[model samples]
Target: MNTRSQTPIPNVDDTTGEYATFARVQVDRWRDGQRETVEDVVAEEVPIALEYNGISHAVMMATPADLEDFALGFSLTEGIVATPGELYECEIVPGCEGVQVQMRIATERFVALKEKRRNLTGRTGCGLCGAETLEQAVRHPKAVAQGGAQFTVQQLHAALEQMQARQQLQQATGATHAAAWMDAQGGIVLVREDVGRHNALDKLIGALAEAETDFSQGAAIITSRASYEMVQKAATVGIGFIAAISAPTALAIRLAEETDVTLVGFVRRQGHVVYARPHRLR
Candidate 1:
């Protein structure tokens, strides 16, 4: 089991913990009525199994990078663990079939996880997998703290601009989504990329938590549409502001309003749309 982080490379085997998140392959190209062969890079989605206290909990298809962060983040956002302290140790084990993140969590949290009795096979786009009832599927977290942090339109736009250059994985494979943590001054603090947008956010959250980041003083910037699950994750972690480069779902807006999260979407250089809690933005 390797917990150290590694950079993703092209077209590598998965027998080791440092598995490649992208692969380079040959592709047929047609341009101007001419056909040729070219090498292309594509994002690799692996079945990442999350095991808590040696019990298999859920499996998600995600890029293999910053997986330790992913494990902690998933645990936190999925309510498996109430706080980062509840998660003790995370081991990244790569195998021929896929990767397994074996986590050792607090006994109390593990007991609660077992009580929920959820065995999810999560896909890249599906967040609520194997949920039996509506209540289990649409979970609402506690409301975020009021008047924690605020950002202006200029800061949001500047963060959006800075985030583009920091997305190394997306620039390589063009098949991954990115989630970045931006401070109030519009500086991109950290970025995480994954095949699944939710996974990316989870990874970012995990990294931020590991660094003891102040969730109230920064915003989450995502390069995908804002979904209800995204808002739920942010609010659960006490993130007061979120900005998306694309549109946000109606359910996401409603949850943001209910959770006192400032949700902004369609973020561009010109302007952006504030769907909920406009007071958070200047």
Candidate 2:
């Protein structure tokens, strides 16, 4: 029942936006050549400011839901904290422009975070937009210690089908992306949706870390394209494989190769493309 953390499950009251997933707006709908006024549902994108130890780190545009997960995931994948234990507690504070996810972390991590970046913020689609240089932008993750996670082509297809059932946010607004964790046989376990693909993956990684799932037993499935940063995030979190509904970029493929991650893309009901470590997915 505690959604804030995996370690102690902080006793703080939940300040996350329970009803802020989507909003309704009036729009014109065309039916049989006739346009009529109707209500349209859109995904809610809010500014999520991440502050570590009261110091502003990054203000990202994300769905105002499961922000605690977002904070934990972002911290791990972004290299702010080496482990989830470093994060003590997360305080969600809603403001005029957006929600500020205040994370109480170890002083060492906070000091390192401050030394890494003085100020950083990014929108949904901007990967490493705030990084100062190419080296900082493409910080590669250490290769996965355990790779060669095997799955069948049929399992990949089934995983894609299961991912659809968990995409509630995308079904509602048709504008959000989802990241799901599925067992090796292709059973959906945990899913997180967000306006940003990276954030969605971060949330999923946070959940995976909480559950401490065996990396060899499952793979990550994403609703968006597999970018270089996506592979980096997966490798950073020690995910052995990734299946995406779209294609993988050149940089993503290269990163997957270097990180020893099995990357699969264009995952539909019938087929998929293996961009990296094809031997892992039959």
Candidate 3:
């Protein structure tokens, strides 16, 4: 698969892996039948290549920041590694055209990954983009480990409110999505943001792994709508319940039902819709 991590571009933050998230640009402003020049900060989008065992896997278009966390989260949520330790090493090498995240995995896992690669694999953002068959497209996640946690609508609202405070990049760019881990008591534990909602969730999931968190113990919230792929990614790691500030795709709701996850959407202060597994909600 040719995941083009866009051709490398010259950057100011060459020394630090932290590439700039946005750049100032001059644009013509037209409002009230008036025209003026204004400086605007636009979110930076770059190609981020993920290479496993020295071989390329995916090239994702993403905002360049919190990459180490991105690498870990992508690996775990993608089922490339069952545990954080299965991934041995990850290195970031900026190329002439894009950035490459080189990852080394346990030998056995590496072998399994290769064995699973087939003629029909690797797709774009959709969960089944690269799927070769219906069975693969609808692959089920492992049963969630048991956990007893319940919360009120107020708690879910509070947790989402907390997410708003931690979104440094999104607040600045207005072009990013955030996926956050929130405790049952409405505490925002971790947040990861990306231009891609999947990437944001993946990064947050990775950060949780780095902290050795029990996925079943908390809920997930996304600033964007929840899709089947989002639910699949969360379920792959046993995230039992997920809330979205927007709506849920029909497929996402169906998958949530099959995966035994609580799918909540339109998470406003006054109300929220529970699509599946409402037993987990109070």
Summarize candidate 2's per-residue lDDT along 146-242 as a digit string, tens digits.
6545788887787778789878989989999999988866788889999999999998888777677676678999998999888999998788899
lDDT-sorted candidate list, best first: 1, 2, 3
Q: Which stretches of candidate 3 lie over 4 Å from their true place?
A: 1-10, 14-17, 118-127
Candidate 3 displacement at residue 172 in angstroms = 1.3
- The 10 consecutive residues of candidate 2 with the worst lDDT sum are 5-14
Off by over 4 Å in 2: 1-17
lDDT of each: 0.89, 0.83, 0.82
Write down the TM-score of every candidate: 0.93, 0.91, 0.90
Can you list the residue pairs that collide in candidate 3? 7-97, 8-96, 8-97, 8-98
Candidate 1 global CA lDDT score? 0.89
Better of 1 and 3 by TM-score: 1
lDDT of 2 at 96: 61
Model 3 C-alpha lDDT per residue in residues 48-104, reported as the tens digit of each score: 888889877777777777788889988887777999999899998877776788999
